[model samples]
Target: MSSLPYLKKLNNAFTIFSRSYAFKSDLKIKWVRPEKIPCFKPEKSGDLQGFSNINKSETILEFQNSKELATADNNVKKLFSLEFAPKKCANNLYIKNMMSKVQRHELDFSTIETKIARWTGIIRALQESMERFPRNIRMKVTLKELIDRRKKHLKYLRRWDYKKFEWLLETLDLVYKPPPNHFHWITRKESLKKLTDKYCDGIKEERLKAYRLTLENEQPAFLEEKIRTLQFIRDEQKACNVVVTVTEEEINDVKNQLEELKKKNAESNNQLN
Candidate 1:
């Protein structure tokens, strides 16, 4: 009897978010989508026979703490690099120091740092790929990531007592609630969890593949960067190597928010019109 209400909530969340985020052709308003470029996930296998070889949804790994784990759209390296909260070592001062190195090397710090961070995160995801994908061939990689992240999270919480952690969890609900699901089948918590897990593996696999490609390409870029830095080379010509291959997800995110704002403005104007 107690579990029934929880299922009711999950069902509602699924319905609300799904309807709000369903696929469409040439959306009339971009703002309805996202202010932040969300993670991307390839469609399920066999959705399109033309691209049958693409089975990214079946293989990649995702750590336990990742926020985008439930989202339909998932970006590989970026998702792995995504952190819910920044710890002390990851504060603004530390970031500024890191950026100084990029400046000294005459490289755009944003691009350099993004790439290095992504590299680190993917390597981390690979390290923890097993716990994330217990059944996958490369499970050890995920396990390593999980262990490392636990240490990091625990390190971050070192100053806080057990009560603080519990309070943090409680505050989350006040600030965030799962979207409601209109789909009846996803009403149960256990049922929803199982369903998401099956698809999550596939998404993780795709992310892993993308990260691999990115890593393969990173070798030459990093070496070239090292060479130029050592030689004290600083020029726009070095920008090519400096460019990090972050997905252009931020653009759409901005557009989506813009659209939402415009929509509200238009509605207000209509009242005047």
Candidate 2:
């Protein structure tokens, strides 16, 4: 006998069990309509079209960490001098100093530090180009690549020597913050804010919409409260009328009893006389 018969029986049992208990899983899946999704659509402009050729996002102008560096205004000579080149170092003098720092056996072009220094020079050139032609997408893309390449070089330095990484960051006047290893995708505090912002004109508009809906849904409750209050007032007035009637009838009966007592007193006086 083959094991196929046993396998078939197990499969049938699993199918029956799944059919009977599938609802217990409490899995709810909702299909969203495409129109309900919020998307950013850039305006169609000739200037924006020039950006289509660029795939990378460039960094905006930022403050350098060091006031002295900022005052120097990113002059190429100042940058090379700040990198520990000789005083009043010209471009060729700066390159000669960088070459002297390389090991005897190491290729000048192949060293990591040499590559990093060369990339910095390239980045400064790109930065100047971008400042002149801010809307040029090609220059922006090239600047982005240079910055990215610098970051990779920094990371390699950090992995080999953390102290050197910190020194480089200080010397470059760039901020460095390591990214977190784990990220939470499901829980977001700003989702509601973003959702409302995307769909509504403003917070005031959202509030007005919410208020209108609340008024529409509250009609039944308002009517019920009005009916209850009117009925309560009517009941109170009826109770006052009943109490006044009972009190007046008792007062009239007491007056009649007093008159009868006065008549009895007068007849007793006449009989005694």
Local accuracy by lDDT, each model: 0.42, 0.51
Highest lDDT among the candidates is held by which one? Answer: 2
lDDT tens string, model 2, 95-178? 333444442454567767666655654555445445567788877777666666766777788899888677655544455433
Model 1: how far is 77 from its true place, Å?
Answer: 81
lDDT of 1: 0.42
TM-score leader: 2
Query: TM-score of each candidate?
Result: 0.17, 0.30
In candidate 1 the C-alpha lDDT for residue 146 amounts to 38
Q: Candidate 1 residues 21-87, lDDT tens each?
A: 6755342322232143211111111011111122223322234345655453555533433243233
The positional error of residue 256 in candidate 2, measured at the CA in angstroms, is: 78
Q: Residue 256 lDDT in model 2?
A: 60
Model 1 earns a TM-score of: 0.17
